[model samples]
Target chain A: MSAEAQTCPALDAKELDRLRGLCRQARIDLLRSIANAGAGHTGGAMSLVEIVTALYFRVMRVDPARPDWPERDRFILSKGHSSPGLYAALAARGYFPKERLSEFDVAGGMLQGHPDMLKTPGIDMSTGSLGQGLSVGIGMALAGRLKGLNVRVFVLAGDGEMQEGQVWEAAMYAGFHKVSRLVLIVDCNSIQLTGRTDETLSLAPLAGKLEAFGWRCVECDGHDLADLVPALERAVAVEDGPVCVIARTEKGHGVSFIANRVEWHAKAPTPEQLAQAIAELEGAK
Target chain B: MAETGLTYTVYDADHMTQAEIYGAVLTRLGGERPDIVALTADLAKSTKIGKFGEKYPERFFNVGIAEQNLFGVGAGLALAGFTPFISTFAVFTSLRAAEQVRTDICYQKLNCKIIATHSGVSFGQAGTTHHCTEDISVMRSFAGMTVIVPADGIETAKAVAACCDWEGPVYIRIGRGFEPRCYENDQYDFQIGKSIQMADGSDLTVIACGPSVQHAVEAAKVLKAEAGLSVRVLNMHTIKPIDKDAIISAVHDTRRIITAEDHSTIGGLGTSVAEVIAETGKSCLLRKLGIPDQFAIVGYPDDLYNHYKIDADGIIEAANAIMGTELEADEDWEDEF
Candidate 1:
């Protein structure tokens, strides 16, 4: 149990509406930053907007002022290439000035193409190479427990990145060890770098496989904040074993032409496309 | 032994291997520091890191058979503000999980120590898969990595304690079992990036690392007695941030240099010394004795050391060859490529 685990408070209608507003803006900001950088992982970052927003805004107990707080809940973007998504959330959450978002992958800039904990203030762990973040979260979780600190560690990984063998290695260790303070959110955004993940390497029975590996598995629509917030809270409540919330999402989630487009995996959106994306998000309530 | 600053150990120093001393030393340090943690990849017994596990089971993590996860978890533990000591075979730590070591630990500049046992061809009978002659090459290339090859169990103890205080990523490569001791005890100062002059002379210098230091010292003694040759033996334990001053001084004092190592002739102690010589533009005749660019054959470690000319007898032969050679005075370059 955590210091903040007294209650899984339900999200009020106004709160949900406000959070949805942040997620929509997060998508717009992340896309603009990617477009500004001239090269970035557009699709994956777009897919992760709500998941990252939910943690920074509602779920996790973190402070933008004290990024080094020992008792703060930790977050790791294991899908590090989707740094723009994380940066947007950090900016929206006031970790740093939102204007710094323009420098997203610029040479000599504070924000790197991947999440670097040393460089970025709010980043808990440096990650770019796939399949390393979960193990790092396990380390943080285990350390917190060892220190008797009531902290939680949340790791958001991509479906395509699951192809990496190291992911399962960490999964097995956490599951076997019953590290309950960790929550793994798999953003099942189907599309990978080349094509659909199912076409490339199917993890069709993904939930069953995770259950077999000894984790408490939960599934939900990653884009729906109401569903996702409750799923995350439920995951946080489980004290018996590690929890894996398989969040079904779509690559390039918000925009019309970019959604599920494989080429947008790492491609920068053109100026016209950015305008369209901004309009689509802003035009919504 | 009391003068060495290390407490008296129950384990017999003469009979025990470097890995055993490392395990004992780590177990002792775990008592002093609460932040210290140990990890292994199903090599707890083989690497002898299990000793620390037995002492502090709560701090120990056995990431069974997953070399990548072992390093990744070690990096993670390091991120959580605990100093993690990870152990595995030299081949796995330096080669199998190279990307994890490089990207996760070295690139991030994490305070994680890698105690890689069974380095070089020490596990000879285990075949080429277990043999790691390329570790020095691979580990030295990674940025922010400190590499050390202790000569014996005493030096291993000193190195293990020293690294606990040194920040950033460090790689300590040691042999599997019973390689003869080079030092009597840990009385001598063991500093990272500094070479220890075992026996001093001016005729020729033998720059060696790991178990090769013992062979070099013995060879120097034999060369002094029989051939009437004055030989200098330097235990170049640190590979990364190598002792450039020592190598440069050896070149200035003794114009002939013979580097011995239980690794490849390409990029171990031999190649590191060669880079120094090339950079200095000095006129020292250099000879490298090691495994001559091939997969080491299966045999006992001692037999393999002899077969590959990385033993005492091999150093004697190489010393003789260097003593008989003359340096070319001409500095004109030729494009051999």
Candidate 2:
């Protein structure tokens, strides 16, 4: 279906291990850059590490050198506040030089406050406004079908951002059209700005509702690539309709003090906090 | 095309509406260029985009009643290299999907066309919710957005075809139905940001866009015969990159001017012309005749136009009143804000 052959197929043990190494280092990169800027969203970026890592390295069929290869698979960071995680993954995958990661902060150009398709090479669509990325993925999937190209579309949506009505509007459109090769992974980080999503506007029984909306729902441990890789493979195999993988992740996952802490949602890491986060991730080595 | 009961006769342009021409031109463009696609937010029959849906079923997408996603999807399709034409009522596209239109489409400068039908008081009896008199004011404020308002069905066809080749985002506003012909035929040349001088005269210039242009032309004819006034009529079809030269030249040629439209005078064509006149430091007796800064009463479009003094007789009256007023002295404007 795609021009590039995958040397790393689904459920490959060695490949999964190699990808996990990148995820940890990418987490290190995410923590360092946002910390360097003295401002940015750290919690959501840390939370989306493994899901974006698996999609960029092991599962997706892509070439970092030719980012605009018409048949290349697409990854849209629907929750664009998690741009640090996406940037780290793209750099690890060789989308651009690793040195370019320095451009992600207060002094912005190559990387804006939000992901811009015009600025970033590997970014498929520009998305900052929540609940807009899914429809873009739907449009790309529809375009792929029309052109007879076997291209897969992936969207990383925040469970907290699910309160926007546009998300359901896109969900209904995707299910009704039966757009295959489109996978939506909701990063259920369980925390958002102000408070937890359920406390703000409940979207519990979310899986049951998505299933009723004509989607094949799967749940997995977001931090563990072993659990995430196989679930992602299952999502791509569904030809009847779309797939929604509910990745139950903890906000600020890698750092001990910030994990599940509501205050870390958009707060910058202080110098002491950065040293502690670095030590926590490095202790795993 | 399958009949949807929206069909009307072309009885010497009396029953013709701009939406019909929009439906015909869109279906034709889809056949000619496979890259062209049509979408409507549950307004296929009402906005007349159903004709394209029937002709190109595979290329058409009805995004249900979700207008925000309609715009978001249109931007996505444009990014995929397809020219997407989004059709819906003006009130929803400008207000409901304003953020989407601004961030997703205009900010990114996507090549998408928004055909906003039932603008102004075209859906007069449908009350304030359906009537969109503020679309012009809102759409013109967005950067890189080309705003156009066609006078009748003939101009609608021409403007639709012209925007197909124009780059960036375009918003073409039109009335609901029966928008009487302002041009004799669709054979004349049409440009995006240029105004057409319908009638040439020296006494005064009457500038109008969309629904009011036809009435202004009729008023110009009446003013010449009865009042012995040689008036100039300008069909200001494009509102954004407005013809500033035409307005300035009108100030120099005929110091008395009147602007009209079926919208609030605050941000529509009238305000646009006033800015040019004020900038050029020309002291002209200018009167903007439009719906006052208020919601129009629920009634037929004709009755509302008559009441608001946007009809032919009302335009003739405004043209006469402006001619008799004294020109403002260039000393600081003793103005009304």
User: Pick by TM-score: which candidate is best?
Assistant: 1
Which pairs clash in the backbone of model 2? none
Residue B279 of model 1: what lDDT?
Answer: 86
- Single out the weakest 10-residue window by summed lDDT for candidate 2 chain A: A1-10
Share of native C-alpha contacts between chains A and B (below 8 angstroms) recovered by candidate 1:
0.66
lDDT per residue, candidate 2, A1-285, as tens digits?
A: 233565366566777778778888998888877887777789999999999988887788888878888878888899998899899999888888888887887565587668988889899888899988888888788877877888889989999888888988989998887888999999999988988888987889999888877888999999988899889988987887899999999999977888998899888788888888888888876
For each candidate in turn, the TM-score is 0.96, 0.94
Rate residue B101 of model 1 by lDDT: 95
Pairs that collide in candidate 1 are none
TM-score of every candidate's chain A? 0.96, 0.96
Per-candidate RMSD vs. true structure? 3.3, 4.0
Candidate 1 lDDT (Cα, 0 to 1): 0.89
State which candidate has the highest lDDT: 1
